[model samples]
Target: MNPLLQASPLPLFDQIQPEHIEPALDTLLRQAEDALSTVTAAEFPATWQAIAAELDVATEKLGVAWGSVSHLNAVADTPELRAAYNTCLPKVTEFWTRLGADERLYAKYKAIAPESLNTEQRQAHKNALRNFVLGGADLQGAERERFAAIQEQMAALSQLFSEHTLDATDAFSYYATREELTGVPDDVVQGARNAAQAEGKEGYKLTLKMPCYLPVMQFAKSSALRGTLYRAYVTRASDQAEDTAKQFDNTDTMRSILTLRKEEAALLGYPNFGALSVVTKMADSPTAVIRFLRDLAAKARPYGQQDVADMRAFAAEHLGLTDPQAWDWPYIGEKLKEARYSFSEQEVKQYFTLPKVLAGLFKIVETLFDVEITPDTAPVWNPNVSFYRLERVGPQGR
Candidate 1:
C-alpha cells in the first residue's frame, strides 16, 4: 500500500481507525473459518462443484476484506495499522497454506470428475489443485516441512522489504529559502512555501514524495540543489537514513527460500524453480520468457542509445561537459525538450489539475463504454468520495 489512498475510490480498512478493524476482521475471519469447517466435515466425498462453490464463499469474503486492509496498509498508511496488519498477515498466510495442504481437503477436491464441472467451476478446481501442489500438498514428511518453513520465511521477508521502503520514503525533508528557490517555477515555489507554512517553518519544504521532490529536480536551475535531491532520493533505501532497511536483510532470507524452492522443484521432478513456476503461465518455459525479454530489449536498444547520444551532444554543447552524470539528465533533458519543441512540461501542467484530469479520463471512458459517472450525493467517509454504478445497454432500443 502506498500512503496515498486518499486519492483512491475504494474503501479502506486501515484508515478506518484501529477500533473498527479488529471487530470487522475478527467477524470476517470467523465466517471464513466456519464455512471451511462445514465444508471439511461434510460426510460425502467432496465434488469439485460442492468444494468450488463452498470455497469461493469463504475465500471471496476474506479476499475483499484483506485486500482492502492490505492495500490501505501500503498506500494510506498508519503506523499502528501497519504493525497490526503485518502481525495478521502471517496468521492469514499460514491458514491458507495449511488449508490448501490439508490431505482430506485435497482428497475431496481431487476426487471430483473433471467433466462434472461447468467451465468456471472446472477452472476453479484446476486452480485449487495447482495451489495445493504449490503449497506442498502432494509432498510428505521432510519435504512438506521444508516447504512450509520456506513459505513462512518468504512471507516475513517480503513484508520486511515493504516496511523498509515505507520507512525510507518517510525519512527525509527538504527546506529551501526564497533565494534558493530563484530558478524554481512560481507554482512549485508556492507549493514549497505552503509545505513550509504547514509545518510552521521559515522556508520551503520538500521530501522524497514524487509530487514535491520531482518538480524541483526537473525544473530547478541550481545544479547543486538538484544533485543534493537526486542523491537523497537514490540513497533513501540504504541503511544510513532508513530504519526499515532491516527489511532488506532479506538477501539471506530470499536465498534460503530460493534454495528450498529449487530443492522442492527437484523433488517434484522439475529442473529448477523457473520450470516449476511457469507450468501454468502463458510463456510455458524459461527459454520463452528470456527470448521475449531479449527480443524486446534488442528492438529498443538502438533507439535508447540514440536518445542517450543526443542527450550527451546537447549537454556537451550547453554545459561544456563531456559526459553527463545522473544528476544532469533531468535538467539537461528539460532544456533539450524545450529547445526542440518550444514546450515545457511544467508550463503544460496547469491544465492538468488532478480533478480535471480525472474528469477528462472519465469522459473518455464514458465515450468508449457508453457509461456515465456521477458523484455520490452523500458519503459515509471522506467528503472527497465519489461512487459510480455502471450498466451495459442492449444493441436495440428495447
Candidate 2:
C-alpha cells in the first residue's frame, strides 16, 4: 500500500514522495465522489448524523491527506515536489468546483428540516446552506461554467505566483569577507561561514532568506552589504532589469490576480473583491473593515513619527550619520535599543536558545491549561520538524 494512503493517527511525511502524489489524490478523489453519490441518492437518510457519518467522514479524510501534501510542498519545497503539486492542483480544484456546484447535494441538505435537528446540527445545516449559495449552487448554464473557470484560473495563478516568489528569493546570494560582517551575531556569522565551507568557498555566503538577511540589516557594519540585500529583498519577482535579475518576474501575474479577483467578485454579486472576501470574515463589510484600518493607522501615526525623529537625531549625534536611508533604519534601531535598554541583541540572544525556548513555552502552557502537552516523535520530511501530542487530564491521572 502507498504510505500516502495509510491509516495512521498522523501523516506519514517521511514515506510520502513526489511519485505518490498523483496516485493517492486519484484514489482519494474517487472515494470522495463515491461517497457523494451515496449521500445524494434517493434512499439516503435525511438525518444529520447519517449524512455526516456516511459522507463527511470520508471527505474529511481526503482533505487531511491533501492538506499534509500541500503543507510539505510549502516548507520542504523541491523541484520534484513542485512539479507533482502543480500536476495534481488542477485535478483537486476541478473536483472541488464540481462538488460545490452540485445541486443534488445542496437539495439533500436543504431537504433536512432544521426544526428536527439539535442546536449544533441546525447551525451546521445553516452554515452548509450559506456555503452552498456562495459556492454557485444556484448558478446555471453559462454563469455556472464561468464561475468554475474562474476558480480553476485563480488556483493556477496562485500556484504560479508562489513558485515565482520562491524561485526569485532562492536565486540571490551575497558573499562577504569577515571584516564586512562586523556587529553581526556570532551564530549568524557561523551559519554563513558553514555554508561557504560546504561549497569550499573563501568568504561567508549570504542569501536572501530571512534568517540571513535580517541579521545583516540589524547588525552588519557594511552599508553597501545592507543596501544590496535590501534592494534584492524588495525587488523580488519584479521586472527591474538592473536592480533585479528579471527572472521569475511576477509583475504580470500580480495584475492578472487582481483582475481575476474583481471579476470573481462581480460574478458573485459584490462591489469588489474586498467586499466578497469579508463576507465569511470577522468584519461585517468592506467599508467597515477599511474604516477600522484607517482608525488604527491614525492611532499609530504619532508613534511612528516620534520613532523616525529619534532615529534621525541618534544618527546625527552619535554615528556622525546625517542622512539615514531605508537600509539604515534597522541598524539604527538596534543601536537605539542597546543604548536605551543598556543591553545588546547579541547579549539577549545568548540565553534564548531553541531548546530553552521550547521548554519555557511548554512550562507556560502546562501552567495555564488542563491538558498535558508532550513531545512526540514522528517520521518527518524535514529533520527540524517536531510534533507534540496534547492530552486531556481529568481528576484521575491520564
Candidate 3:
C-alpha cells in the first residue's frame, strides 16, 4: 500500500517516496470528484453537515496528502521528487479550479441557511459564499473558462519561479583563502572548510546559503569578497545574473504571472489583484490598505532618515567609508550596534542554546495556558524537525 494512503493522523514521511505520488493522488482526486458530484446533486439537501460529511472529508484527505508532498518538495528536493511534483501540479490545479467554480456546488452553498448554523459555522458559510464569488463562480461562458485557464497557468508559473530560484541558489559557489575569510566568525569559517573538504576542493567553500552568507556580510573584513557574494546573491534567478547563470532567469516568468493576475482580477470584477485580495481580508478596500501604509510610512520616515544619517556619519568617521554601497550597510550596522550596546551579536548568541530557549519557551506557554506539553514521536522529513503533543491540565491531574 502507498504510505500516503495510510490512515495515520500524521504523514508517514520516511515511507512516502516520489514513486507513490501519482497513484496516491489519482485515488484521492477520484474520491474527491465523486464526493463533489454526490453533494451537488439536485436530490442532495442544502445543509452544512450533510454536504460536509461527504465532500469535506474527501477533500481534506486530498489536502493533507498534497500538503505533505509539497512540504517534502520544499525541504528535501531532488530531481525525481521535483519531476513528480511538476507532473502532478497541473492536475491538482485543474481539479481545484473546477471545484471552486462549479455552479452546482455554488448553488448548494448559497441555499445553506445561515440561521441554521452555529456561530463558527455561520462565519465559515459566509466565507464560503465570498470565496465562491472570488473564485469565478459568478462568471459565465468564455470568462469562466479563461479564469480556470489562468489559475492553472499561474500555478505552473509560480512553481517554475520557485524552481528557478532554488536552482540558482544551489548552483553558485566561491572558494576563499583563509586570509580572505579575515574577521568572519570561526564556526562559520570552519563549516565552510568542512564543506570544501567534503567536496575534495581547496580553500573555504562559500555558497549563498544564509548560514554562510550572513556572517560574512556582518563580520568579514575583506570588502571585495563581500561585494562578490553580494552581487551573486542579489542577481540570482534574474536577467541581471552572470551569463552562465542566465538560464534560470525569471524575467518572462514574472511578467507572465503579473499579466495573468491582472486578467484574473478583471474576470472577477476587481479593478486589480490587490482589490480582489482584500475581499477576504479585514481591510475594506485596496484604497484603505494603501492609505494605511502611506500613513505609516509618513509617521516612520523621520526616524528612518535619522538612522540613515547616523549610519552615514559613523561610517565616515570610524570606518573611513564616506560613500557606503549596498554591500557595506550590514557591516556598518553591525559595527554601530557593537559600539552602542558594548556587545557583539556573537556574544549574545552564546547564551541562547536551542535546548535552553525551547525549554524556557515551553515553560512560559504551559504556565500561561494551563496545559502540559510533551515530546511526541512521528516520521519526519529530517532529524532537525520535532513533534510535540499538548494536553489540557485537569483538576484531578488525569
Candidate 4:
C-alpha cells in the first residue's frame, strides 16, 4: 500500500496520493533496513563499487518519495501534509546515518581494487570512503551510538529551525485603506485593490510575499507608509516580552543553528563547517571569498556615494528637506531616474506580459542550446503553468 512503490504507470510517480505517503514510507523504511542488513552481513569480498551502486539505487527510490512530499508541503501546506513531512524527514536521515555508520560495509568498500574502477567510479568510491570515515564508521560500541544520536538530533533541530522561520514569514499581514494609499501609482494601487477584492476585504492587504509587498514599499511616495513596511520587515521576530512572540524575529533560531553547526563540524574533525562545505565549492578558502566581496564593494563604493549625494541634493531642492532619510531614498531615486532618462519602468512593464516574457526566455534559451520545447496541454498543478520537454538536437545542424 506504499504510495511511492505503487504498480501504477504514471511517469515520475504522478499518481502518488498524499494519503499513501505514511504507509509507503513505513514500507520503504523496512525495505531500506533489509538492504542495509543484507549488505553488512555479506561474507564474500564486499567491493566498494558494488556497495556504492546498491546505495545509489536505494537512496534514489527513497529520495523521489521524499522530494514529492516535501514539495507538496511547501507549496500547498495543510496540517496532514505538514505532519507527515516533518515525521518522515527524521526517519530518512536516520536511515542514511545508519548506512553511513556501518563498519562492515565500510571495510568491504575499503577492500575494493582501485585499479579496477574507472575515473568516475574511482571518484565515487573515494567519496563513499570519505563519507564513512567522517561519519565515524570506524567507531565501536558507545562511540558509534553517540554519533548516531548526534546526527538524528541535528536533523531534528534543522527541521525545527526551518519550520519556525516559515511560520514567522506567514504570520504578518498589513492593510491600508484607499484614502491612505494616496501616493501609490495607479497600476500598483489597482493590483492592491484587486487583491483586497479577492480576499473579500474593503481595503488593501499586503503580506510578506514579494509579489504583494516589495513593489508597494519601493514605489509608494509617502515616507510614513515606507517606514512602517520597513520596520515590520526588520523586527518580525523580536521578542515583545519574555513569553510573547514579537513580529518576525528569528534571533534565537539563528543562534541555535550557528552553535549546532559549529559543534557538529568539530565533532567530525573539521575546524568549521565553512571549510568543510566551501572547500569543495569553486572558492577554496574564506580569505579568498572575503577578498572577492571586498573587491566588489570597492568597485561599487564611489558610484554608490555619488548617487547618495545626488539624491540628497535633489530631495533638498524639490521637497525643501535638509536631511534625506532612508525611507525617502527609493521614491526619490525613481523620480530622478524618470526625470533624467524620460523613461519609466511601469511603461516598460506594459509590453512585457508574463506570457510574453516566458516566450522570450524560451526563444533565448532555444537559440543558445539549439533545443526545441513544445508545450503539452495536460492537467497540471496550476492552470497558468505549462510543461515543456527539452529534446536534444542531432549534430551536423540537425
Candidate 3 positional error at 300, Å: 1.6
Clashing pairs in 3: none
The ten-residue window of minimal lDDT in model 3 covers 389-398
Model 2, range 285-375, lDDT digits (tens) per residue? 9889889999999999999999999999998898766998899889989988888888787887879999899889987887788778899
Q: What is the lDDT of residue 351 in candidate 4?
A: 97
**Stretches of model 4 off by over 4 angstroms after superposition:** 7-18, 44-49, 138-143, 183-187, 198-200, 240-248, 319-322, 377-380, 396-398
- The global C-alpha lDDT for each of the candidates, from Candidate 1 onward, is 0.73, 0.88, 0.94, 0.71
Q: Supply the TM-score for candidate 1.
A: 0.84
TM-score for model 3? Answer: 0.96
Tell me which residue pairs clash in candidate 4. Answer: 236-247, 236-248, 236-249, 237-247, 237-248, 237-249, 238-249
Task: Provide C-alpha RMSD values for all models, in order.
Answer: 4.6, 1.6, 1.6, 3.2
Candidate 1: segments with Cα more than 4 A from true spot: 1-15, 239-271, 367-372, 377-387, 396-398
Candidate 4 has an lDDT of: 0.71
TM per candidate comes to 0.84, 0.96, 0.96, 0.86
Error of 4 at 174 (Å): 1.6
Per-residue lDDT for 47 in model 1? 74
Candidate numbers, best lDDT first, in rank order: 3, 2, 1, 4
Model 4, 1-398: lDDT tens digits are: 45577543222334445677777777777777766666667665466556656665666667676777777667767677778877787788888898887887788788889988889989888888888877778777876787787788777777666676676667766677777666677877788778778979888876666665667666776677777666655555555312333533556767766776776666667798776666457898777888999999999999999998988888788856578676667778877777778777777878999889988998988889888766765424445556776666658543
Q: On TM-score, who's better, 2 or 4?
A: 2
- Pick the lDDT winner: 3
Q: Which stretches of candidate 2 lie over 4 Å from their true place?
A: 241-244, 394-398
C-alpha-based local distance difference test score of model 3: 0.94
